[model samples]
Target chain A: MTTRVLVAKVGLDGHDRGIKVVARILRDAGMEVVYTGLFQTPEMVAVAAIQEDVDVVGLSMLSGAHLTLAPLVVAALRERGSDIPVVVGGIVPGNDVEDLTAAGVAAIFGPGASAEEIVTAITTLVPQGH
Target chain B: MTDNPYKTWREAFDAAPTRDADFTTLSGIPLEPVYGPEEGEFPGAYPYTRGIHASMYRSKLWTMRMFAGFGTAVDTNARFREIIAAGGTGLSTAFDMPTLLGLDSDDPMSLGEVGRCGVAIDSLADVRDLFAGIDLSRITTSMTINSPAAVMLALFVAQAEERGVKRSALGGTLQNDILKEYQAQKEFVFPPRQSMRLVRDTMAFTAAEMPKWNSISVSGYHIREAGSTAAEELAFTLANGFAYVELAREAGLTIDDVAPRLSFFFNAHIDFFEEIAKYRAARRVWATWTRGHYGAEDPRSWQLRFHTQTAGVSLTAQQPEVNIARTAIEALAGVLGGTQSLHTNSMDEAIALPTARAARIALRTQQVLAYETNVAHVADPLGGSWFVEELTSEVERQAEEILAEILDKGRGSMLEGCIAGIEENWFQGRIADSAYALEKTFNAGRRIVVGVNAFTEGNEEEDLAILRITNADEKKQVERLAAVRQARHAARVEAALATLKRQAADPTINLMPALIDAAKAEATVGEMMGAMVTVFGRHVEVPSL
Candidate 1:
């Protein structure tokens, strides 16, 4: 099965180099990837995730707005009654990791995360039934 | 063993196996094992391949201009004071996203984003607060803003006037480069033609009125950050600069008139020798093109002055302390390459806005490089090296090819051609391809990043203190913006914006005067930009299929 993932950048952060790199990495891994480009609102990301029926959501944020923005994506998913596992990456402070996980994020990938680690985490975190 | 004296050493050297890897640079320039004397004469001469100045750092050290701004204007002002106290020579301002996009801190779209990435400057009030105690006459201030750069420059000029300083006496660089915004940074607002008009207005205004200020700093920093090769960065930045010169000429100024004030900004990535070569090549290419192609007569017009920032993209959030070494090396490359000024990225920048302590350490890296390392004693110390010469010429040749391609795309004008390229997504496509290729190589384990691919460390966050901006900061900024709106007379702002809109519609009239009037009237960034948006529609990039 081709693992479907939606790589998203939410809020007003214009740094897209990291997110673009992640999208290409996922695509190279033989996964179906849809990128919801820069300045995407939570509503936009959630709608895209549902429409694409992605198995995992990889959110890339660097403006220290992950705590505010990441939870919105998770909550929007909950509002839609979707169980797509969300993985957050990019400059997530270590102290906030446990909180984000507690808030229903499946995994957190920081600056030095390898492609294998990221791909493996995404593959394992997604439910087999999906 | 053989009887010959060198037989054993030669045999041993041949027996040892070397790693089978490509010896080319990121731009695909081939490298040799050693370098000796070759082409190119002494530094500080015509066609300045080695450097633009004779003394280089020996006579005057490069300006240590640290890019620091976050939270509200007052907060950033305090940071500026701290930077000056800690021995920084100049200041570079980084505006927040909303401000960069020409939106007020109180705009609905600016919620939760106020003062997050950089300082939020809504009106002249914020700009005034930004430089409260700093003497504008004494220190050079470089602002990193595009799209709404004219508006920001107007605000800065207004601040200087308010402090009883002559506009002619004010000195600094305004990153009025909009072409790069369209191509890489993605901070563009109005359509291309309209945006260039704004850029034209600033160039003409500064060249005539503010002779001491650099009207624009043509930047390749963002292009490199967007994953361009060194050659691409050089070629794209120089091409954009050529377009600006052409635009100024069309606007009725001679090339020499505007060209002298023109400057450049580049990214110093971790590739030490290659980075140095890139800068050297950049100067040679710019000098040749401006002199031969543009017919620039003034020596200053032919010289390429640039500022180099240590690559922010190269920093790693994991084992972030090691980034100090990375910055030091990159800064050294910038110095050796003869940068007029430099900014060293803090180790923690990859994670969050640089903490005050982290920023100080970053500044000190430059201090050590400038004062301690005697490498700055000579200009282009590697000028005659065979390897560096090959790399420099190759970089210049590749950049020339790209420039020719861009010029051909424009028909006759590089400016027209670049606008065409932007519309056709030529620049974006090339950058995307380069970025994707680099990322693929990193993923395939062909390239090993110390903390990333190899010697992987788990979380070392326990010891690090990342700068945290709270929600309270956003609330406070919005409140400040609200108060400014209340205090200013609404009629004055409305009248000034009307004049601005009227001038925006009439392309012949310069918008700086009208914009400065708006700034004086206390018009917010969003309001003034909104008025212009009425005449010149906003730009919404059509994503590639």
Candidate 2:
């Protein structure tokens, strides 16, 4: 069994350092990783996820647009009837992590999160062989 | 009574080298148990493992270049004056996305983006307005622009000439590094090879005329901020720089002629000492390579002068105020590491473009360090410090290895290979692995960042107003852009663009003169870019693993 994660950078946040890093780590860890490049609209992110048929949708947001951008991606995924677990990482404030989680983000990794921990979280959330 | 305390300490320290090893690098470079002269020789020498100059900051203070740009030319001009009055010795211009991408404000694609991130300069008129009272002859300026950098530079030259300032007298830099734009920053107009051509042309032009001006600021700021590690940033940036030198030489210019004017821009990230070591290692590596590999004779050409901006990614949207502290530390690292110019991130940067007050505070932070602190009193104050020297050597080694890997892929035509590596998430993979590992440490209570995972705090409202660029400004910009298009002679514009397209097709003809001619005929950025697109074609990034 394999865990598939779609790592997408939504909106105008050109900062992909985190997302790219996570994608590489997941791929190396034997999880399939799909990376959608910069300026990905929410619709684009969801469509890519569905097309790729990934188990987790990881959104990396650095532009303060996360408040507006992250939720839109989650909502778009839901509207598409996709229940794939979602995770987000970037300069997300601690207080907003819970709000993001409540908005259907399964987990949130802020600055300083380890790739292993994120990989572990994704595995736990959608356990391999489940 | 004498239980051999040293032996006991060694036993405890060596208990678990694998799990409990206390290391001091993002890549986990092990710390030496101790350091002697044998570890690293000294400062002001080969490998420059300590400091480049014998007396570093003590001899000259780092240039306080506050990055300023906002709204229209008039608005940005005001900000520039305010910053200079408040002790900014150098000027750094930040153009709006449209300007950066070579679109006039009135273009359809530039509707809402003009003057939002930076200033909007549609023509030489706006450029004149931008530097209205400023003395270009006396003070230096750095333009944070790429893509259509050649046009912007031509406007700058024409504007200076209009004010009776000679091109030779112009002392500044243009972020003419278009390669990095394709690599990290998305604001690119022409394809990679053509962009390199423009850079070479500009280098050729500047080498002949504006000798004091830096033709290219090979930037790793965007790359590092985009998620590269300190070593990746240093290595990739130097590789890009070497590629440019090779390109310039291919264009019939000698290495020594252009190397001196070449500069760099780095992102001073949150890792305090790591950032410092990166800078130190950069200088040594650049000096060694230019002198040894490129056969650069000029000492100035060997020196790696750079500008730095505090890592924008390090700032948090949650506890916005905490960003101030982070910026301060980053700025300190940059200053200590010997940056020629520095821009501290505004506290509210994580939210939006900085307001007037926030920009002031950011400038004042540099001022406080310059005048108020004793950090500037000594040159390379940390020079020969056992830890700093070791870290510097480690970074240099790592960076050199990365550069070798890049060079081995292909030196001159590595753009495709580089992009392929990126698509395969090679660089991104390394950065993510390090970033995640660091985060894991913090989460596991092994590492701690104040006001983050370890520090729980109540909700606190920010006292400052986050400046937002309104849609009305965008509308005005569009209207202004439209008016300019309406006023300019359509026939002349079309003729100039056709001429530009013709010149662009020929490799021998320098594109700068034609680009300037196009700009003079009121050719909008989009039109010029469109013409080039017809000739050069758009770059379709290759999809990889």
Candidate 3:
């Protein structure tokens, strides 16, 4: 069974270069991909993730709001009683990784994350629950 | 008679005040300043394939403009003073995401983004705080705002007027090119046709009133960063510019009046030769169109002046310090390409906002290139090189091809076609396809990005201490926004916005005066933009991946 993933830009940053590439990466790896468009608030993203019923949700935040916005996204998912794990990507500093992890973000991908690494992380996080 | 270019150059070389610098290679081998080219194709001549100016950087080095902004107006103001105090001639402002989107700091849509990406500005008070100590008359500013650019520029002029600076005394460039926002950047607010009206309004006002101002800096920088190829960036930007030229004619503005005040902004991407060729191709294409298509008589109308910024997408988070080397190479490419101004990317930008140390290094990169390197001593130094000439011509051909497609899409009207293309996702789909193709090659190990795919031994990202804006700053900005609302007279703001709304609905009225009135009444950027939005319903792009 193929895993499914939802990639979303969760804040005001309009930069979708990496996430677009990630969508193709997962698609080529035989995983289903859903890309929610830009400027999504946490609630909108959570609603989309739950409605889409994806195995994992990936949020791209390049506008340095990841520290403040990513955790809200995690809590937003929990608030709606969805345990779909979330991964935060883009320009995340090393020092903030612990806080993001503590906030229940499952994984973090920075600028240079490879396609194989991203696919592996997604597959491992969502375990064989197609 | 069309004389041979070499002989013409020879006669002019002897008659003109003999060039003052030593024309020699590093080993002191005597060398000619520049090789010959066609009479009509030389620098400062028709179609300006070489450069818009004859001397190029020999007389004036490209303005070393550094883009800096973060946190609040106070925070960005300190940085501006430092840039000007440190011998930097120009200041390029980077507004925070909320400000860029025309939201007040307290707007719910602006949560956590108030000061995250750049400075948080809500009112004319914020603008006053932004330029507190800096003399507005002396320093030139370039604002990177689009959707709300008219409001931002109005606020700026109001601030200058409060300081007793005449409107004519101001100098700056407004990134009023709304076409690219729909095509790439995705920061658009109104429908493309309505947005073009706002852009045209600014052009009409600035072309008449503010002689020193550049009304529309039709930009390809964001398009390139959003994954466009070099030729695509050039073609799309020039296409948007031509759309404005046509739109201006519709508004009763002449080509010569608006064209001279129009400028361009481009990206100096990682590919060295390709980036240089893109700039050369850009000048040729712009000059040819402005003359043949627009029927402009002023020579200034034919010259394409531009500012170049090193590509931010090329910077990597792994081994972040290596970006310094990359920025230097890209900056050198911009200089060689004859840019009118430049902004070099800071090394640590890929990881976070650039730390002060990282920003200093970026500025020093330009200083070294401008002063230490002798690349600027001669104009179009590579003019006659076979490889460069061929690449330049090829890039020109490719860009013209792309422009033709866009023109056909509009059915001969670029403005209409761009709006059609946006609705059809033509630009977004093409960019995504190109980006995916490159990603496929990298994933297949066919293309190597150092420190990522190759040279991975002992590679570690050094702790460059990236700049981070805290939520505390957000709270502070919100409080300031609250205070501003409480202080300003509600009646004044309401009346001003009422006028703006009425004028926005009537296409005949130039909205600049009304916008300036609203700003003078201390109306927040959001309220002013909201008024216009009500008149012109909001626009949302169709989702594309």
Candidate 4:
């Protein structure tokens, strides 16, 4: 089985550099990558993740809205009866990272996290479960 | 041979050599060991390759305009006072994410974003609180806004009027360069043509009424952040600036009237000399185009005065304190390269919003460069350097090529060309390619960013004091917005919005007066923008190649 990942940018934030980079890395890692482009709502991301049956969902935010957006994404995934692990990356503060982790985000990639680390973390978390 | 005398040194160098190849700037501009007059033109002269002003900082230091905003208007107002009190010269305002996107704090879209990134201002009341104790006439302000720049400017003018300050007395630069938003920042609200119309309306109105206010700050800061090469930043920014000039002329404003009010904003990145050369090249290119192409007679129209913020994209979360050194170097480049104003990034920006202490440190970084470094004592100190001049020429050559390409796309009309290119996603695609290339280099260890790639410290992020906006702040902001909505006369707000919608529908009418009226009626930012969106419709990029 190959790993399947969904990359989504929630809300009105348009900082897509990090998310786009991650999508490329996942695709290069031989995973099936589905990119939800900018200005996506929580429900949109949730529906796409469920429909794609992704093993993991990755969210990227640079606007400091992870505290609000991450939980909504997690809850949306749950409401759709999906158990896909969630990972996030961007300029998220440490406190927010803790909060996001507590809110069921499986992993957080900060500014210095390498593509290898992110890919490894995803592979470890999902383990080719798609 | 004469080289036989130094044969031993050469042999040693060959054995333990440099890592790879010859040194070059981040933009891949080849540098020389020395610079001379053979490189280009002189400072404070036509085709200003050196300095725009002959004396440069010797006559007056560049303005220490730090971008301060966060939490409520009152909070940012207090921060502004603190910055002024700490020997800062001018003010630059940063709006919250919600406000930047033209949403009111009470809107569902604005739920968790209020007061997170910058100060939240939903109405003129918030603007009034933002400048509560400060005298508008005493200090100049530069707002980092687009899409709704006219609304923000109107709010400023209305607040100034409440303070009995004449509209002409206020001074500031509006980041009304929406073309760059489509290219880089991606904080766009309306379609390209409609947004350009709004920009043109503001330019025409400001040219007539607000003589001291800069109607547009043609920006390259976001372009650089969006992963463009230095030359690409220069080319795209100047292309957009020319498009605006063309757009204003199409709207029937003379070049002399609106040209002087057009300012620029740039990014002072980690490459010290390249950043300096980028500024020098920018001045030369603008002067050449404005005088030769637009036939501008005024020196102000030919001069390229810009405000620079040290690159936030260059900062790293690992060993965040090292960012202080990075900022100092970048700020020095802005000074040496001749900027009108500078903002150094806070050390903690890579992690979160700067705490007050971090903000002060950022300001002190500028002060140290201005007063202690003594680099400002001479005008274009590196004017005749072989390396600097060569880099400057290379930047100019590359930028002019891009500019020519953009103009060619316009089919003789730069504005049309910009519109066509934006709709075709040319600029966005170019930036994305550049960004991808840089990321590849970084990931492959070809480019060594100090704390990120080269000098790897394992999980070095310690206890960092990052600014956090609590849930209480959001609740308070929402309630305040609710109270404002309840307090303002509903009929007046509706009437003002209706007039805005009417004006928006009619391209013949300038929308500034109606926007100002809407601001005065206490209409929220979202309401005014919502009305316009209803008239002009909203826009979203496809982001596909």
Q: Candidate 4 on B357-457: residue-level lDDT in tens? A: 88899999988877665566555778778799899999999999999899999988788778888889898888877887888888898989887887766
Specify the poorest-scoring 10-residue window by lDDT in model 3 chain B: B10-19
Clashing pairs in 1: B410-B417
| Interface RMSD for candidate 2 relative to the native interface | 4.7
Model 1, residue B529: displacement in angstroms?
1.3
Docking class of 1: acceptable
Candidate 2 lDDT over A1-130, as tens digits, reads 6888888866544455567667767887898887876656788999999999988999886544565567778899999998888888876655566777778788888765665778789898885575
Checking candidate 4 for backbone clashes, the offending pairs are B34-B386, B35-B385, B35-B386, B36-B386, B410-B417
Who is ahead in lDDT, 2 or 3? 3
For candidate 2, the per-residue lDDT at A99 reads 71
Interface Cα RMSD, each model: 2.0, 4.7, 1.1, 1.6
| TM-score-based ranking | 3, 4, 1, 2
Ranking by DockQ: 3, 4, 1, 2
B368: Cα error in model 2, Å: 1.9
What TM-score goes with each of the models?
Answer: 0.92, 0.80, 0.96, 0.93
Best model number under lDDT: 3
User: Tens-digit lDDT track for model 1 on B314-362?
Assistant: 9987788989999999999999899999999998988789989999999
Superior by lDDT: candidate 1 or candidate 3:
3
List the pairs of residues colliding in candidate 2: A17-B226, A17-B227, A21-B432, A112-B439, A113-B436, A113-B439, A114-B436, A114-B440, A115-B436, B56-B379
The C-alpha lDDT values of all candidates are 0.87, 0.76, 0.87, 0.85
